[model samples]
Target: MIELVLPARRKDLGGFEVGRVLPAVLKRAVGPFVFFDHMGPADLPAGIPRTVDVRPHPHIGLATVTYLLDGEIVHRDSVGSEQPIRPGEVNWMTAGRGITHSERFEKARAQGDHVDGLQAWVALPEADEEAEPGFVHVDAAQLPAFGEPGVHGRLIAGSALGLTTPVPVASPLFYLHLELADGARFALPAEHADRAVFVARGEVEVDGQRVAAGHMAVLATGRATDLVAHGAVTVMALGGEPLGPRFLEWNFVSSRRERIEQAKADWRAGRMKLPDLDHDEFIPLPGDPPPPPNPMS
Candidate 1:
């Protein structure tokens, strides 16, 4: 059964716009996913200034999952990792203690650069919150593929369709990307107690209600629920066991509020290192001494 539908809060970043769907006032998260951003399907003109690039930023107690559907991004991190992620590839960076990184678009198209993809932050388990930081890139070919020829999909993590993906995860969860032909109906995996589906580029029908693009439907798992595409659609199906209450502050997430305070102190005092390649600039912590972190549901 369907529970609630959340709309992405659109934010315009000069030539690009990001749609944020998670961590809203209504619901803090879906399973371990604490933050979710839908990056452009926007086109940037040739020779666009580099000022628009994401400056090096710091994160802790979570993993940044970057997947591109179009265009390219050069990822540089403080761990001496420099990787380029293209369409159908997954860039998973775990900032257990702390990590800094930046994403630059040097592969801008001649006429314009087409960027479209999703970035999600999964909060770490309490026991692994302070583990070592690391980064890994998984190719599209390595992800397990399933579904009929016309209705295809890929398992990005966990077990689904009797296949498990190679993407490393710290918890029990499943993430999937699906392409459904118009009028084709599909059942979501019921193994997880908490789950939701985000419509990235098309509308879908769930529980006799229509959910348009840039929106997500949180489902009450146990019984089966079928989603039918209104047209050709691509969606992300994700969720798993809950990670309990978490404290969120700026770019930091932790089970302990004092840990968040420590991260704030580290970034404010320049204790956190910036990305190796993009060390020339870094995003300053907003609000200087930010307000007390809050416990997220």
Candidate 2:
């Protein structure tokens, strides 16, 4: 059953920062998901410019999903795929063996554009870690929408309301983008009893407990759960089958220790290609070394 796991808002850092996260995986080894980041629903004043300049970075053993609630992003990958992802659209990138990419604004927000969205990383099984890299872009109209008046649900990934996301993935998982008007209440499936809710906009009450914006509400594992929107609200729910043993090193994710080690070496030796970008300010630099091996291993 779905159980509330994480209940925390994205902590802000400085410039261009909305929320930064290294989220906890509540069940099993990272669960069926790994990384989740709640970005902006931040507003930009007219005539002020802003841009998302995530430099080229490498990822392995996972697929990345970029969904926008407002604004647009131009995604470019090492494989030469470039696409503009607008509101209600998704950019799903699968980095089987390994892939590098960058996400930046299509145009300066000051130029009358705005930015708001979430970036998620879903892990792949051990066997698919080294598969070829690929990507799929799904428009807003293609995703399934359901729920009663005053409350709406968008199935960004996995299946809901008899509809499934068009992006190919490795496991059984669900990513829901939902919004509810004030005074609206909705029920989640009993299977999602342990799910976590990240409140991006406004406040909500789960099982009678109130949670405001910038905070997360983790539901205790049990039967079906209920939530009421105290105001206009937006939340993202991630649920899936539990994952097995895995390790994260830098941006590389793998189930095998040796594979992660090799990925580190490959990156250090410059064997992997970086995503192309017009500016160098956003490029990702090499980070601190990985942690020591597990003593029990």
Best model per lDDT: 1
Worst 10 residues of 2 by lDDT: 277-286
C-alpha RMSD by candidate, in order: 5.2, 6.6
Please, what's the RMSD in Å of model 2?
A: 6.6
lDDT of 2 by residue, 1-297 (tens): 223434444465333556633355543233456666667766544454223356567788988899888877789887888899987888999998888887765464436466788887888876787889998999888888888989899999886446688868787777888899999988876464235676778888877777777655555555666888997999777666666766876677888889888877776666777666532323333575643333321
Which residue pairs of candidate 1 clash?
none
Candidate lDDT scores, in order, read 0.86, 0.71
The positional error of residue 193 in candidate 2, measured at the CA in angstroms, is: 7.9
